[model samples]
Target: MTVVSHREDRVQAARSQSSPARSRSRTGSWRPASGHVFVSGYVVLLALFGLVPALYSLYLAFTDASGKFSGVKNFTRSAKDYRFIPAVQHVAVYLVLWLVTLTIFVVLLALVVHRLTSRRTKAVLRFVYYVPGALAGASSVLLWLFVLDPAVSPVSKLLRWTGNDNFAQVIVPNHLPAVFTIIAFWTGAGGWIVVLYGALNTIPTELMEAARVDGANAVQTALRIQLPMLRKWIAYMLILSLAAGTQLFVEPQLVSQASFGIVGNDYSVNQLAYQYAFSQNDFNGSAAISIDLLIVALICAGFFVARGRLFETD
Candidate 1:
């Protein structure tokens, strides 16, 4: 009876020791269906809204007015339009100005905000930065029109200082790129600043402390540690900004209408596409133009992803 009791005690101890290991292994291996359930809605929405439209547009781009496969005829036709190249050029110039300004300023502002030690100050500043993002889309553009109007604008003197004595002068073809850049930055930069600031907060305090111990100054720490850590976030910002810049429609379109054709109907590729579809009744040409923009966006995204190693788990 004593020998049997000793064997049972040993077996029970063994089971107790192995039970935790078994539980941990099961926990690690047992991925729940919840993740798939959560993602299903997004996948459905994407398919319904994004995939469907993109596929239809792709089909339209390759077909003629009569619905027969026309190869690249629609693309060639859109390219041959007099307004196409110039619209593309305008969008290109605006994108360059907008992207450079956005990158420099958003990163700088985010860094500055992140350096604030007081939680209240950080929160207040973040709220202030995000305030402009609330006025997005057409309303933001209209608000800018009012702000840029030298005649009644509160910054009229500043505009006068820059030789822009009226809204017309402010939005002149020669200055439209800068004007659009400013508007875009005002409406867009705030959100990105908040995003980057949040990303900066994710950096471990221990790493920062180590940097300090190693005699790295603020600038060195930022450049070497923080910025490198933020590579994926910055890449995401640039990709989205590039995509938005290529679309360049609402602001220029509203400015054109407000300025009574001064900005022209075909100020950007999207506007040109709109003209093709509505004014010229050329859906194929419009789809072709859209495909061009889509290609540019995809190429830009690919470049950023490659350079930033965005998909790498490490």
Candidate 2:
């Protein structure tokens, strides 16, 4: 009878231990399932919004409107087009100008603002600077068009140095792009200044204080300490600016319209593509141009990723 009681007690203890183990196993399994569910949803959203469109565009780049595959014919044809080289050159020049302007003017302006004032004052200045960004694309281009005019513009005093009538014709073939670059910078640099200012604010205040205590001047601290700390932010800004530079459309497009055929219809790469697709009804050519732009954007993205500066710190 005692042996029977001992055996029953051992069985009960085993069951008690096994019960907790089983419960823990169930809980662990459930956590993985929940995680998998979340990952699945994320992948689905990415595929729908990102992957699918990208893949479709790729397909379009290789095919005609009738859905007949042409392999690399579209790409070759686009390259051979009369306007291709000039359009590429135009965009390249614009990119260089735009990126340089953004990097130099925006970063310098932000740093100056950071040094000169209190946080409240800086905030107000940033708002004032960013006001131009509020202007619609059409509005900005139209405003600049008027500003470039010798007869109508208040800045005609400055324009007269280059020949009032000749200067008013500034949007001529060779000089038009430089004018566009200046207009774009004036309208765009403010927002970037605000962005860099935010980055400047993230620098540790103690670092600045230490530098000051060590007898470092404000200029020394800004150039040596603050700028180095801002490397990642600056890299991010460069990538963004490069991407925006490649997407230059609205400025040239509106300028083309406002100039009344003075700025050629094919003045910009995007304008060339639009003329191909809408006026010429060449969807393949349009897709090819789009793919070319996409490749440039991808290269920029790849550069940021390869540098390990795209997202949060490694």
Candidate 3:
């Protein structure tokens, strides 16, 4: 009896000692992990903001003008829409210009700004470059309006110098691709410069010195060492820029508005979607067009995701 009692007492003591630890693991560790609440909140917000709208849009895309299930009719109609192909082509042209300019010029400009000046001057120039990007959205559009207005623009002399006698010449249909490219570069390249410049900074000074010792000139070092190091950032920029370029709404819409539809009746797929949903009240058509854009963006994003090793650092 004494032995049994001793064993039971020991068992009880072990259970008692372990209970608090179990409780702590269950309730304490879960009290809050770092970023747990933030991540959870983001998930909730995404559900509310992203998932719900997507589901609703999906539902709408398959429905008719009468809110009845019309199968793929809406999508077919969207494909056959008069403005559809033109909108797609417009967006394609804009993206080509915007993405190419951003990729080449942002990197080149960052390299130039980083190498050509003292630290103070470089910092000042970076601030100036970043200002337009900081003022993106409606404000940037308004600013570009001033810049492109041949009457009062600081570049009026240059525009006249280039034989762009009026705003019409500045934003003609054939020249729109170039014009939007210039505007996009002006507003968008700044943020990217900041990113590339920061990436350049992360390149160890030792690497540059080693390149010098190996008789690599500035151009060679930038092209070989610096450029190679910037590959990941450039790829990331490509993916994001492609996605953003695909959604070419704000610039086109505002410019169209500013130009009083002389720019176009429809400038992009996104504009078509917006007009369908908001103006024409053809929600199904809008959803269908939006799905097309979503697919294109997903393809670009998928490439980025597939090349995951680009993001890794030793």
Candidate 4:
């Protein structure tokens, strides 16, 4: 009986030690498998929707109507189109205006929101900010058309005061850059403000407190401490904004239709590409326009990634 009891004790001790090892192994194995499952799905989607289309665009850009490689002919052909330079100029002006507005206002609003001590107030304000962004792009643009028109708009007095007594006057070509910038900002900046506010939350409270202890005022602290920490977030916003701005299709296209071609069919690079493909039946030219925009986007993204040290660990 004594011998049997001792053997049972030894077995129990061994089981206790091995159980933890088995649990650890199970945990480690499950984690990697779960991670792989999530990542594999994303990778598959990106390859299918993002990578494949880009590669096909590249092929189309370099090939002729006969599917033979035509070198840079398609590129030069698109560039020589009469409307090309104007579209480029319009896009340039809009980008410059929109990017500058986004940088200043988004960051400023975010800083103001972050300064609020009441959690409920912050939550409500964040929701309010994001509400405009919830509207579809076309819907937002259409909504703004009414707002910009003095005839049927609630802000008719304000529109008239600005010398835009009619929709035509409001949407004139010279005013289109500012008009587009306002539309883009109204729909886009809200979401970015919410994003920047969230980024501000990720900053450690201890650092903020330390800054306060050193007699740093709100403006000083934001400029010296918080803004510096938010460099990467701002860079990311700029990169994405630049990409979306360069592909400015929906606003100008819809506006052109609404204004009876006052804004023109080729008001943006993407619109020019659309006109090339469907209107002119020039697929290679359309692809070349798309490739040009893609190259610009890639270069801007690379610049931000490098200058912002986006991947570096804190």
Each prediction's whole-model lDDT (CA): 0.91, 0.80, 0.85, 0.92
Model 1 lDDT per residue over 99-196, tens place: 88988899999999999899999999999999988985899889888989988898999999989887888888878898889888988899999999
User: 1-314, model 4: which lDDT tens digit per residue?
Assistant: 99999999999989868787566676785343677887998999999999999999999999999999999999999999999999999999999999999999999999999999999999999899888888999999999998888889999999898888799999998998899899999888999998899899999999999999999999999999989999999999999999999999999998999998677889998999999999999989999999999998899899989888899997
Q: Which ten residues in a row have the lowest lDDT in candidate 2?
A: 305-314
Residue range 175-282, candidate 3, lDDT tens digits: 778877887888889889989999998999898889989999889989999997888888888888888888888878888887766887578899899989898988
The runs of at least 3 residues in candidate 2 whose Cα sits more than 4 Å from the true structure, single-residue gaps closed, are: 1-52, 166-168, 304-308, 312-314
Inter-residue clash pairs, candidate 1: none
What's each prediction's TM-score?
A: 0.92, 0.81, 0.83, 0.90
Q: Model 3 — TM-score against the truth?
A: 0.83
Q: State which candidate, 1 or 3, has the greater lDDT.
A: 1
Best by TM-score: 1
RMSD to the true structure for each prediction, in A, is: 3.2, 7.2, 6.8, 4.2
Which pairs clash (backbone N, Cα, C closer than 3 Å) in model 3?
none
Candidate 2 structure quality by residue, lDDT tens digits, 153-252: 8888788877657433777777766876787787878888888888888888898889999999978988899887777777777787777777778877
